[model samples]
Target: MRIIAIGDIHMAADAVTRIPEIGSADLVIINGDLTNFGGTDDAKRVLDTVMTANPSVLAQFGNLDKPEVNDYLEDLGINLHKQARLLRHRLCLIGIGGSNKTPFATPSEFSETELAAFIEHAYEQARASIDLTEPVEKIKIPTIFVSHTPPFGTAVDRLASGTHVGSSAVLSFIEERQPALCICGHIHEAAGTDHIGRTPICNPGMLSKGGWVEITVNDTTVQATLHDRI
Candidate 1:
């Protein structure tokens, strides 16, 4: 599966247009922060641009997003998986939204404990809902987790204070349930890739500033490339 992943578009529709076509992949995952203010209109505009790309879109709402904004995206047929999904024959994708509590207390800010609880709930929901009769093992699939907040201690999560303010809860979750890949983008400056356990964790950074990650997944391996648009 070829999956192009980006995040923190912040309502920059042109960034979506700039995504290079991948003839090999089966889907696209927009990690979050699709709007500047989580306004319904902004979400709709972003949804329209994504749909035009003509690939399956897996998305979640960022802290800037309002409830109505997410609803609007759902109405437009964008798959909003706060939990998880199995895509094609080889990919299992999961999403978590918002970020650890920030000073601003934005619409998407959550405490570390709160974020952990949400992630746990999502994982339980996925386990309960997924059919086990399928040939591929759910746990063994090339699972990719999406979150608006980066995991702690990654290059893609360094704050202006030089603090790595990523979610420790997220890091714990990944440690407990190691997935094939993890993608995130909330700390714009920390826009890059690294590893957590066996999983390849990536923060495609802020698309509005022209950063994105390209991923190719097959039965044997997964490869990711990070790029910045000039």
Candidate 2:
């Protein structure tokens, strides 16, 4: 399947207007940070704009997102996932919103311990619900994880201080489960793709400044491409 993913929109109406022409992909995934300031009104505008642009849009909340903002997106039919779910044509997607705790204490801040627990819980729940013995054709599909924070030490997460601010818990989870893909964005500068074991981890960067990432996946292979709008 062809998937176009982007993040960090930060409430840019121009970028939203340009999105439909980006490509006619089978699916569109918005990583996070849908607003400049996470207010209900701002979130409403962002959600309305995006839904109008793409009917197949899948999104999650960012660090700046408030509960009202999340509720608004959910009301507009965006999948705000703290867990995984299947989408168009059996594409499995999991979304975790927010980032590791920062000094500023943003809306989406989660301590490393809390984040790890959350991921672990989600994985266990998914594992319990699936029947592995069933044929792949008959059984539940595998998932591609989507989050706002990248896993630690990948090329997609190198900060300006030369530090890796990604989540070790996320890295561990991917190493264990090996999802089809991991798409994320929080650090604007660290926009690219790398692998955790067999799964590809991608950070599509920010959309407000006109950046995005595209990925193609089928039954067997996956590839990613990054682009910057002029």
| TM-score of every prediction relative to native | 0.89, 0.85
Error of 2 at 43 (Å): 1.1
lDDT of 2 by residue, 27-64 (tens): 77887788865777887777677667666777877887
Count clashing residue pairs in model 1.
3
Global lDDT scores for all candidate models: 0.76, 0.73
Measure candidate 1: CA RMSD. 2.6
lDDT of 2 at 92: 60
Query: Candidate 2, overall lDDT?
Result: 0.73
